[model samples]
Target: MSRLPPAIFLMGPTAAGKTDLAIELAQALPCELISVDSALVYRGMDIGTAKPPSALLEAFPHRLIDIRDPAQSYSAAEFVSDAREAMAEISASGRIPLLVGGTMLYYRALLDGLAEMPPADAQIRAALEAQAEAEGLAALHRQLAEVDPESAARIHPNDPQRLVRALEVYRVSGMSMSEHRARQRAQKAGAGESERSILPYTVAQLSIAPAQRQVLHHRIEQRFVQMVEQGFVEEVETLRERRDLNPEMPSMRAVGYRQVWSYLDGDYARDEMLQRGVAATRQLAKRQLTWLRGWDGIHWLETSARDNLPRALKYLESLSILS
Candidate 1:
């Protein structure tokens, strides 16, 4: 067995009870919580991101949440770096790092590492933004499909940040983003396991979801409605008061936030915003599940199961990672 420190990844789609499970596990084990969510990183995005309440956060003390302003941008590479540091600190304190959230891309980057790509060129990004403004996002997506079909297929057409970045990588590096990732994969394939793995921790991957797809869909719809009742529109209204923020920024484009921002902008009515928000959340869950389904070595648990905490502990015991 490897002599690395132990870490736990509690992954699932939105409204899958992952936060509750992680909190239970933390209470049982000597673990520090590190959020693996992209949306939760932004400050003042509480209701929409489903961020833990301030009281709960003060008690549990999760790292990497609300670390950025809504006007700024955060990347997967930054997340990987911050997460590694947090994990190292937790391990040094003689505790395991329990990462919990539904952000599949962040989990993948932390696990497998990211490829080296060209740095962002402001001129290129500005040009792409202008092109998007003139020709539309669909046009940019079509252009990406021509050059990087794999990336185009993976990134949603509505994801302007990723879509723009993919095109920028092609423009700056003279190679598709997919090619850069493929090259990195090829290099890792020839390396030893220790060298290939970016994380030094012996990780236990756990995923929780409702047993039935329809159940999850229902839960998602209910959660979105709850968020609205919890002043989701007012939250967006406060954000709209900022001079620097806009609908196109990564933070604003989050599943529910975008719909609410559009509604506030008079682009749609409140009812339409509610419908779009719920649909967008369901789509996000679908994408997250698609990523997890292709993942290996995951210990699956049903959200409805009462014995999940014990089952997760049993898995850790089997791996001999629990001290």
Candidate 2:
């Protein structure tokens, strides 16, 4: 275990002061920061994503930020591949790689290797779309229930993208997504140590959040309002001018952006947009907390505590990760 290179994971829900804590640790330790966020990869989405200010980013220089345009898609597989390369570079340079973000899926894929599943087939997707058009989304969902009940139960009927992809996976391969994941787990169990370990690092995982759920809810609401005051609407307006972008795109589907875009489209009044945006952000935080609650071997810190840096340092020392 000591032969593996040292790394750190700083994970937390949004508005939990994770960025500030990460910066503090980076300053104190020989560490290079790598972003694990799904939205931070986009080039033009700054205010809504609450990306670090230009000066701060320049000083810290996190890897994998602003590496893709909004028109492009970034997958968990891509994140794992890119992150491994970044980790290798940081370790080779004699510094620990400090990955920080609220994107739990990326972190999960990086920790447990992704299942090797069949790729998307355009022909199958087109057929699924046509079938949905003919026999409403509910009917398609029912079909998915018959074929892959586990995925059907997990994915909401309103989430057409995931609904379609789940069915697509079933059609492309004769196996359900759950089956593929189980197969991957079984194979890993039978494999050698070098083959089973996906992330080759002595990792120290830390999660920070407000002790009270209401405090986090309040923070999410206040932060959404603050983002709007910081010209989040204008930022979306600039992206709207791009012909290739739309509300259905993954970038625009980000919590705050979706609400602001609807407001601009006259779907609702500005007040309603603000309310919906804050609500959506709170929901996002709840989901993040749910994920963190089930995670294993993570050190928890309170967002309201002033001595988080010292506490985190002590925890790392206990783990023998910092000498």
In candidate 1, the residue pairs with backbone N, CA or C atoms under 3 Å apart (3 or more residues apart, or in different chains) clash, namely none
Query: Which segments of model 2 are wrong by more than 4 Å?
Result: 130-159, 193-196
lDDT of each: 0.92, 0.90
Model 2, 1-323: lDDT tens digits are 35788899999999999999999999999999999999999999999999999999999999999999999988899999999999999999999999999988898898887878899999999999898888888988998899889778666565567788889999999888888888878777777534326788888999999999999989988888999999999999999999999998888888799999999999999999999999888877877887789898899999999999999999999988896
Score candidate 1 by lDDT.
Answer: 0.92
Stretches of candidate 1 above 4 Å error?
Answer: 191-196
Give TM-scores for every candidate, taking all chains together and pairing residue i with residue i.
0.94, 0.92
Candidate 2 clash total?
0
lDDT of 1 by residue, 1-323 (tens): 65888899999999999999999999999999999998999999999999999999999999999999999999999999999999999999998999999889998888888889999999999999999999999999999999999999888888888999999999999999999999888777767454325778889999999999999999999999999999999999999999999997889988999999989889999889989999999999988998899999999999999999999999999988796
TM-score of 2: 0.92
